[model samples]
Structures are given as structure tokens and as C-alpha cells.
Target: MNETTTIFGIRAVIEAIQNQKTIDKIYIQKGLSGHLFMELQQHLSGGEYNMSYVPVEKLNRLVKGNHQGVVAKISPVAFADLEEVVTASLEKDTKPLFLLLDQIDDVRNFGAIIRTAECCGVDGIVIQKKGGAPVTADTVKTSAGAIFKIPLIKVDHIKDAIYYMQASGIKVFAATEKTEDLLYSKDLNQPLALVMGNEGKGISPSVLKIVDEKAKLPILGTISSLNVSVACGAFLYEVVRQRL
Candidate 1:
């Protein structure tokens, strides 16, 4: 995997943004103000940016060169188009399975889930543009290069993706404990999209209301919960098992 690219200096960051680079995050020095910085702000206006205001020491730690109080991390891979991926998958003869991640915040968990999805023959994985883990060097390493093998699509909202899936005639299911239905009971051999939620919150209430069905893993052990990535693997493999 290629190392995460860092663009520093106000002018350099502006150029990268203007070029439509997939920026993971941007760090700026607190109380920063200058002509060049103003230009960068103009470029950043009216957009969803994962920006943070930190001390110059933080900026220095982010990069070795003079950052001009600005540092931006660029994604190594281009994000896939949701419509294109969904449409293409529907055209295939085999049943298509898609994975929807609702604000998965851990990079390692995200990477592991990607690997699992690829292994299970998922058509693609959809993630929201914000309020989720940023793609970084750790994410790339944890996926073990499976990140490159799968189609990773981003959307402004998870619910929007859910709506699209429903309209396209794909069954949407949420992996949550709220339902009495065990995962094994569900008829999984169909075109489906599985929704997995944030680690601490589970699936959002708004999301839970819309999914066609909800299923849970039988937890016989004392612990009531499982890691999001592990749970995702179990849910995905059930789909694989049913189809075979």
C-alpha cells in the first residue's frame, strides 16, 4: 500500500483541494490568519471537511516542513460511485450483497470489515463521508491490501443509501440486538444490503426504522455484545452459507 500523502503549506493545500483530491482530514493552527490562508478558506467554504484547529506544535508533529499552519492528508485510493457500483452489480447474473457501515469509527475495524466483505463476495461497501473513521495509513495496513480489491463508495448520509437500496429492490437488513429474530432465521439467499452501526451506539434509531428487517446473533455467552467487525463477519458468512 502507498503511504498516506501529506500536503502542507497554505498554497499547496489549496492546489490539492482545487484538484479535487480525496482529503481525509485537515489540521490548521489555532488563530491562524494570512492572505494565503484566506485563499484556502475560500476554497473550503460550503463543504464537508474534517477540519481541526490545533497548536503549531501539532502541525509540526504532523509534518516536518513549514506547514504555514495547514496540513491535509489525502486518501491513496479513489472512492467509487454508488450509482455505478449498484447498477453494475444488479446487472450481474449472481446475487449481489452490499455492506453498509454507519459511522464505523475505528480504522482497524473498518479495515477488517473490508477484508471480510471481500472474502464473502460483497458487491461493494458504502460509508458516509463524515462522522466516520478517516482512511489513513493504519486503515490501509489493517486491510492487508484488500482495500484495493473492493469497491468503496461514499455518501453524504447512510439513510440515503438505504433509500436507494430499497428503491432498487434489494432487501435491507440491520444487524442489531433490538429484534428477536436470530440471523440464521433470515432468508439470506437474495440481493441484500446489511447495515452495521457504530461501535458504541449500534444502528441509529432513524436507520432501524427503515430497514426491511433486523436480526441478531445468538449470544449465549455472558457478554451481551461483540465487536462490530466480528459481528459483521458472522452476519456476512451467514449470507454466504445460505447461498451455498
Candidate 2:
């Protein structure tokens, strides 16, 4: 992670939260208590945040300067409003393709997927607020700066984005090995969102139940599965091929 994107000190973190900055996570020293911390608590009361209570030693390792028992990771890219991005894409004349990630945990995988999506002309990428990888400096590096080129959206749940996509006349397809349908057989030349799941769990059963269709890439080799990023590139390029 880059120090530039991280802010320490209780007051500074509190200000960032108050300013409504897109914070990926917050680390508070365990058993920390002070007037400033109390003030920070007031701001954090009802909000949904990825918070961790760690030791002061961990906080020390996270930042060099005086942290005052709090350190926050701020997202380098501003999250786009999902409704606005979807609405704007709908107005465009070309078919809109969106990528929805279901709790993708690895930063490198997330970054590679973003790079591939941008290359394939995807309109936007949606991820959940809490479960997915936080956009760190490593992610920005691995993406080769493609993170800045696309509209990255964060939603409360992946299902919310799927529902929105379906309501907006976009078909949603979940990429999972559980399906017999092949990716090449699907007609990708239309407005649609593709759901890529986590590394281990695959797509959530509930999510699989709601998608308009489920498709998978063939695994001819001895390995039964491909890396999520590699699999994502294959799926995206197939869309590119079918559209052309």
C-alpha cells in the first residue's frame, strides 16, 4: 500500500470520514480510548465500514508517524455512482458491458481484471463495499494504471448490481464451473453484466440462483480451474469476439 493513500492520526481519519472520502478500511488500536476516539466513534456510529481493532504495534508497522491509534486506507480512485454509470451507458448507442465481482479477494486478480475490462471496452466494474480486495498501491501498479480509465463502482451487495442490471434490460451471466453452458455458446452481443466470483468459494449459491444465465470456460488441461484473472480475460475477449 502507498503511504500517500493512507492517513493516520485520529483527527485526520475522523475528518476523512466526515468529508465522505471513500475509505477502504480503518484500523483502530485495540482498547484505545480518548476524547478524540470518542469523537471519531460519533462519526462512525451508523455507517457500514470495514474496521479492525489491532494492536498499537500493528499500527506502528502500518505507518511511521504519530497515528494516535487510527490508520485509514483511502481509495485512490473515486467510486462512480452505479445508477449514474448505468443510466449514462444506457444512453449511449453501443452495447454496454459491465463486470460485477463477487468478493474477489486478491488485489492482483482484481487489478488484472480491471485492466482486461478496460481493454475489452467494458462500461463499468462493480464490486461490493466490504468483502472484496481494497484498491491499494499494488492494485494500481498491477493494473498498469487502467484503474483510472474505468468507472469503478462499489455497492452494498453484488446482488444489488445484478438486480439493477436486469431491471435496466441487461442480461447477467455468472461465470462458474457449476454450469454446463459454455461461454462460446452465449450470445454476448447485447447489454449485459458478467459476474466473476471469489477464488475459493466460486459464486454464491444465492447469486447463482438469480443470474439470467450461467456459463463456463472449458478446462481441457489437467487443472480443473483457472486463475480468476485469467478466466476473466477469456470471458471478456469472447464478448469482444462475438460482438465483432
Cα lDDT tens digits, model 2, 62-164, are 9999999999999888889999999999999989999999999999999999999999999999999888889998888888889999999999999999999
For each candidate, what TM-score against the reference? Answer: 0.94, 0.94
lDDT of 1 by residue, 43-150 (tens): 999577888899999988889988889999998778999999999999999898999999999999999999899899999999998788888888888888888989
Which structure among the candidates has the greatest lDDT? 2
- What local lDDT does model 2 show for residue 222? 100
Kindly report which residue pairs in candidate 2 clash with one another: none
| Candidate 2 minimal-lDDT segment of 10 residues | 1-10
